[model samples]
Target: MMFEPTIWIGAILMGLSLGLLGSGGSILTVPLLVYIAHEPEKAAIAESLLIVGIVALTGSITQFLKRLVDFRLVVVFGLPSMLAAYFGAYLSQYVGAQVQMLIFASVMVLASGFMLRPISALPNSNNTPNSINSRVDDFTVLQYLLLIIAGIAVGTLAGLIGVGGGFLIVPALLFIAKATMRKAIATSLFIIAMQSFAGFMKYTYLQSTQELSLNVPLIILVTVCAVFGVLLGGKVVNKLPQARLKQVFGGALIPLSAFILYNNV
Candidate 1:
C-alpha cells in the first residue's frame, strides 16, 4: 500500500507472526524498518512503537469483548507501568541511539528467557485460593507492592524497546496475580495498550520540535494485516501446546537479539 515492496512485505510478515505467535511481531518490525525500509534506528523505534501500539490495541479489543480482561489487575499493573513508561520515554530522548538499541536487545534476551522458563504446577485451575489458613491463599499488601514494582520495571523496558511489554507482563500476571494463562494474556493486552499510549505520548512530547509525517498507506496495510493476524492467532492458540510454543519462540529470539545488538553497537 505504501508502494514500497520491502516495507509492505515486512508488515505482512509482522502481522502474520503476530497472528501465529502471540508476541514476536514487534521484534520482527525493528529489523525490517532498519534493514529493509532503510530507516534510521531512532525513527524506526518511534515508528515501531506506533505500529505495535495499534496492533496490540486492536488485538486487545477482541479479548475485551470476550470478557476475558481483568480490569482489577489491569489497574494494579497499568498504573505503575504508565508512570514508568513516561520516565523511560524521557530517558530515551537523552540516551544515545546505540545505547538504546543495546538496551532493547538485552531486554529481548531476558524476555526470551522468561518465555522459556517452565511454569509451575498450579494447585487448581481456577487459581482462587481454597482456604484462608493456606499460606498461598492470601493477598498481602507486599504482593501488590511486588506487582507494582514489576510493572514499573517492565514498563521502563517497554518504553525503551517500543514493545507492548507482554513478554514480561504475561509471566508477571501468572506469578504474582496467580491468573490463569488465558486471563494473564488477556489482562496483559489491556495493560500493554494503556502503557503504549502513555509511552507514545511521552515520546511525542520529546519529538514535538520535529515535523513528523505519517505514511498513511502503510498504516492501512498494517492495520488490515494485523486484524486478520489477531483472528488467526486466536483460533490457533488454543490448539498449540503452550510449553513447546514458548520454547520455540524463545529459541528464535536469542539469535535475533544478539545480531541486532551487535549490528546496532
Candidate 2:
C-alpha cells in the first residue's frame, strides 16, 4: 500500500483514543480506515477489526501478566459472543453500507451515553483484597447464563461495527459480576481482545479479497506510537478521577459519530 499522511494521523489519533478511554476508542478505527485511508466500507470495516484486535491484545497482555484477568467470566461471555459475532458478520455481508453506518452511529451514541454515566463503586468491605480472597465466589449457573445473553448482545454490536465491545463488557462486569472498577476494566480489556479476535476471524472468513488500501507504513508507525501512548495512558488512568475521565471520553463520541454518519451518508 502507498504511504498516506492522512491515514497516519488517523491511526495516531486512534491509538491515543484507545490509550485514553480503554474502550469505545476502537470505534474510531473504521471511520479513519474509510475517510482517511480511502478504503471501501467493507474493506475498511474488516481491516479495522483486525487492527483493533491487535491493539486490544497488546494492552490486554500487559494487564494479564499482572494477573488482572478474570478468565472464568471471559470464557462464559466469550463463547456466546463469538457465536453472535459470526451471525453479525454474516448479516453485514448483506446489509447496505449506508444502513450499516447508521447502525454503527447509533451504537456509538449508546456507548457514549454508557460512558458518561457515574462510576459505580463496589461496597467498601468488598473493595479490600483480603475480603475478596475470603469469599470463594465462583460463577453460578445464573451468572453464566446471564453472561451468554450479554455476550450475544455485545458481540452483535461489535460485529455490526468494528468496536471491541469493551464499553459494554466493562459495565456488564460491574453490574453482573459485582467486581470492583479496577477489576472490571482489566477484565473488559481481556474479554475485548478475545472477542475482537473471534469477531475478526468470523468476518474475515466471510470476506474474500482482503484489501490493504491504507498506508501500511503509517499503520506500523501508529501501532508503535500506541505502545508508548498506552503506557502513558495507564499512568494517566491512575491519576485522573475515573468519572470525569469517562464523561470526557464518552461525550467526545457524539461529534465523532455525527461526523462519520454525515460524511458517509
Candidate 3:
C-alpha cells in the first residue's frame, strides 16, 4: 500500500515528541499507525510497541551513561510490569478494534491530564544523597504495595495499548519510589523498554493466527528517526522551557482524544 507524505510527517513528529518529552510521543504512535498509516488497530498497537521500545531503550542508555537510572527501582517495578504486559498483549486479541480505540482514546485523555500539570507542582528530586536517604527511610509498606500495583497497571496498559507507559510510570517512581525526577525519568524508560518488548513478543506470537502483518520497513524508518530525535532532544532539553512544551502538547491531546472518541463512538 502506498503511504501519504502526511504519514511520514506524523512518524517524524512522533519520534520528535519522544526525544523532546521522553514519554508522551508513544501515545501518538497508535493513532498515527491506525489512521494515517491505515493499519489495523491490533497491528498498529503491536507495531507501536516495537517503535516505542526501541526509542525508549536508546533514551535509557543515554540516561544510564549519566548515572541517572536507578537499577533497583527498575527491578522492583519492572518485573511485574513485564509479566502483566505479556498477558495484556495476549488478551488484546479478543478485543474489537473500535473497543480498543475507545480504550486508547480514554488513556490519551488521562495522559494529557498528567501532561497538563505544571512541572513546578511536582516534587523536586534534587536532594543530595543524604537527604534522599532520609526520605527513603520513610518509605513504608503502603508505598511498596502502590509501586507493585502501579507497575502492573503500567505493564498491562503497555501491552494492551502499545504505549511505553512512561507518563504513568514517572509519577509512580516519583511518589511511590521517592525517586528524583531525573531518576524517575531514566528508570521509567528502563521499565518501558522491558514492558514494551514483552508486549511486542506476545503480540508476535499471537500474530500466527492473524493474516495481518507489520510494515517492517516503516517500523525501521520510524525507529531510526526516533533515535535521532532522542539525541537531539537530549542536547536541547536544558534550553527549552519544559512547562510551556508540556502545556502545548497536553492541549493538543484534548482535541485528538475527542476526535478519536467521536469517530469510534
Candidate 4:
C-alpha cells in the first residue's frame, strides 16, 4: 500500500501531543490510521496499541532516568490494568466497528474534560523521595480499592479502543496515590507501556486466522516520525507555560471530540 503524506503528518502530531501533554496523542492514532491510512477498525486499534506502547515506553525510560517514576505505584496500578486490557482485547472480537468508534469518541470527550481543568488544580510535587513515600502512605484502603477499579477501567478502554489511557491514569494516580502532578504524569507513562503491550499481545493472540496482517513498514515509519516529534515537543514543553498549554490543547479537543462523535453516531 502506498503511504499517504497525512499518515506521516498525523504521526508527528501524535508524537508531539505525547511529548508536550504526555497523554493525549494515542487518542488520535486510531483515527489517523483509519481515515488517512484507510486501515480497518480492528487492525487500526491493534496497531495503535503497539505504537502507543512503544512511545510510552520511551517516555517512561526518560522519566526513570530523571527519577520521576514510582515503581511501586506502577505495580499497584498496572497489574490489574494489564489483565483487564487483555480481556478487553479478547472481547473486542464480539464488538462491532461502529460501536467501538462510538466508545472511543466518548472517551475522547471524557479525556477532554480532564484536560480542560486548570493546571493549578493539580497537586504539586517536590520531586523528593520522602514526599513520594508520604503520598503513598496517605492512601486509605478505600483509595486502594478505587485504584484497582480505575486500573481495570483504563485497561479495558486501552484494549477496546486502542488508547494508552494516560488521560484516565494520570488523574487516577493523583486521586488514589496522592501523587504530585509530575509523578502522576511520569508514572502514567510506565503503566501505559505495560497495559498497552498486554492489550497488543492479546489482540495478536486472538488473530489466529490472521485475517489482517500488520503494515510493518508503515508502523516503522510512523513510529520513527513520532519519536522525533516527541523530542521536539519535549524541548518546547519546558519553555511553554503549563496552564496555557493545557488550555490550548483542551480547547482543541472539544471540536475534535464532537467530530468523532458526529461521525460515529
Candidate 5:
C-alpha cells in the first residue's frame, strides 16, 4: 500500500479540528487529498465526501445518544439537502475541474469569515444558548421557508465543492431555526452526512461512465487516521479553547485558499 506520513498528519489534524470544534474537517480533507495525496480534483472531491461523511456521522451519533438532535429540523433541513446534493453532483460533470476548484476556493474564503466570528454572535443576542428551545411545530411560515432554502443552498455547495457545508448549516440553524449552538452543531453533522453520501452516490456513477477513479485504499487510510485523531481531540476538547482553535484554523485557510486561487486562476 502506498503511504505518506504528511498525508496522515493532515488527516489527523483534519479530524482533530472536527472533534474539537465540530467543523472544519472538509477544508483540510479536500486539499490534502488533491495536493499531498495527488488525487485528481474530481476524484478527490468525491473521496472527501466519503471520508467526511463517515467522520461526521460518527461524531453525530454521540449527540444523537445524548438526545441533542432536533429531528423535526433534520427532516425539514436534511431531506431537501440530500436531494439537492444528488442533483448538484450530477451537474458537476458539465463543469470544468478548474472552475470547480475556483468555486471551492471561494467557498473556503467565505467559510473562514464565518469561523472567525464569536460563537454567540452566530445567533442573535435574543437567541442565546440559554434561550429556550422552541418547537419546530411552532415555527412561522417564513422560518420553515428559511430552513428549506438554507438546506438547498448548503446541499448544492456540498455536492459541487465537496465541502460538508457544516459552517453554513450551523449558522442557518442558529439564525433561522433558532437552535442553540450545541444543538445546531450536532444537527449540522447529521445533515452534512446525508448531503455528502447523496453527492458521493452521484459521483460514483461518474466513476463508471467518465473513467474517473477513486483511490479507495487511500480514502480508507485517511478515514481511519482521521477517526483516531477525533478520538484524541475529544479527550482534549475540554482542555482546549474552542474559539482559539477555530481562529487558528480560520486564519490558516486564508493562505490555503490563496494558494488554490493562484493555481486555479
Candidate 6:
C-alpha cells in the first residue's frame, strides 16, 4: 500500500488528544481508519482496537511507573472488560457494517455529552488538574460488583465500536470505585489496554474466518505516530486549560459524529 500522510497525521492528533484529554481521544481512531485510510469497516474497527490497545499499554506503563495505577482495580475491572470485549468483537461479524458504523457514531455522540458535562456533575473526585492522586480507599463489596458489571458494559462497547470507552471507563471508576480523578484516569488506561487487546484478538480471528484482513503495517505506522503524539501531549498536558479543551473537543465531536452518521446512514 502507498504511504498515507493523512492517516499518520490523524494518528498523531488522536494520540495528542488522548495524552491531553485522556481516553476520549481514542474515539477518533475508527473514523481515521475508515475515512482517511479507507480501510474496510470491519478491518478499520479491528485495526482501531490494535492501535488503541498499543497506545493505551504505553500510557499505562508510564502511569504504573509513577505509582499511579491501582493493580487491584485493574484485575477487578480489567478481567471482565477483556472477556466482554472479546464477545463484542465476535458479535460484530454477525452485524452489518452500516449498523456497526451507526453504533460507533452514536457512541461518539454519547461520549461528547460526557465531555460536555461539568466535571463536578459526575462523581466527586479528590483531584486537581496538575497533581496525581494515587490514594484510593478499600472498595465495598457492592462497589466491586458494580465495577465488574460496568466493565462488561464498557468492554462490549469497546469491542463492537473500536472505541477505548475511556469516556465511560473513567466515570465508572470514579463513581463505582470511589477512586480519585487521577487514579481513575490512570486505572482506566490500564483497563483499556487489556480489553482493547482482547477485542483485537477476536477481530484477528475474524480476519481469518470472515475474510476481513487487517493492515498490519498501517497499524504499526499509526501506533508509532500516536505514541509520538502522546509523548508530545505529556509535555504539555498541564499547560492547557483542561475544562476549555474538553469543551472544544466535545463541541467538535458533535459535527464529526453527524458527518459520520450522514455518510453511514
For model 5, how does the per-residue alpha-carbon lDDT over 1-265 read when each residue is reduced to its tens digit? 2477898899999878776766787778889998999899999999999998888787778778878778888999999999999988998899888999999999999989988887656664243545546689989999999899989988998998799988788888888988876777778878888999999999998888767899989999999998887667756776987777778888899999999999999
Clash pairs (backbone) in predicted model 3: none
Give per-residue lDDT, candidate 3, residue 132: 46
Runs in model 1 lying further than 4 Å from the true structure: 1-22, 119-138, 210-216
Residue 241 displacement (Å), model 3: 1.1
lDDT of 2 by residue, 107-213 (tens): 88988998887765423213556433322156677876787899999888777676777778877776677665566666677676666777678766775543324
lDDT of 5: 0.85
TM-score (C-alpha, index-matched) for candidate 6: 0.93
lDDT (Cα atoms) of all candidates against the true structure:
0.70, 0.69, 0.82, 0.82, 0.85, 0.84
**Per-model RMSD to reference:** 3.7, 3.2, 2.1, 2.1, 1.9, 2.4
Candidate 6 C-alpha lDDT tens digits along 1-265: 3377788788998888777766687999999988888899989999999999988888777778877788878888889999999999999988999999999999999999988987776664447553333233456778878989999999999999899999888888777776767677778888999999999998888887888887888889999999988777767876977677777888889999999999997
Q: Candidate 4 lDDT, tens digit per residue, 1-265?
A: 4467888888998888777767888888998888778888888999999998998888777778878788878877999998999999988988988899989888888888888888767665334555565455567899888988999999999999999988888878876787877788788888988999999998888777547578778778878878877777766766877667767777777888788788877
Residue 100 local lDDT, model 4? 94
Error of 2 at 177 (Å): 0.9
Candidate 5 lowest-lDDT run of ten = 123-132
> Over the stretch 1-265, how does candidate 1's per-residue lDDT look in tens digits?
2567767766765655454444666666667666676666666666676777777777767778877677778778888997887777777877777887888788788868876776444322243544212232355788788889999997887677677677777777777777766667767766777776777777777775543344545556655665666666766766866667667877888988989878986
Q: Give the runs in model 4 whose Cα sits over 4 Å from its true position.
A: 1-3, 125-138
Q: Which candidate do you rate higher for lDDT, 1 or 4?
A: 4
Best candidate according to TM-score: 5
For residue 208, model 1's alpha carbon misses the true position, in angstroms, by 3.6
- Model 5: how far is 91 from its true place, Å? 0.8
Cα deviation of 56 in candidate 3 (Å)? 0.5
TM-score of each: 0.85, 0.85, 0.93, 0.92, 0.94, 0.93
Pairs clashing in candidate 2? none
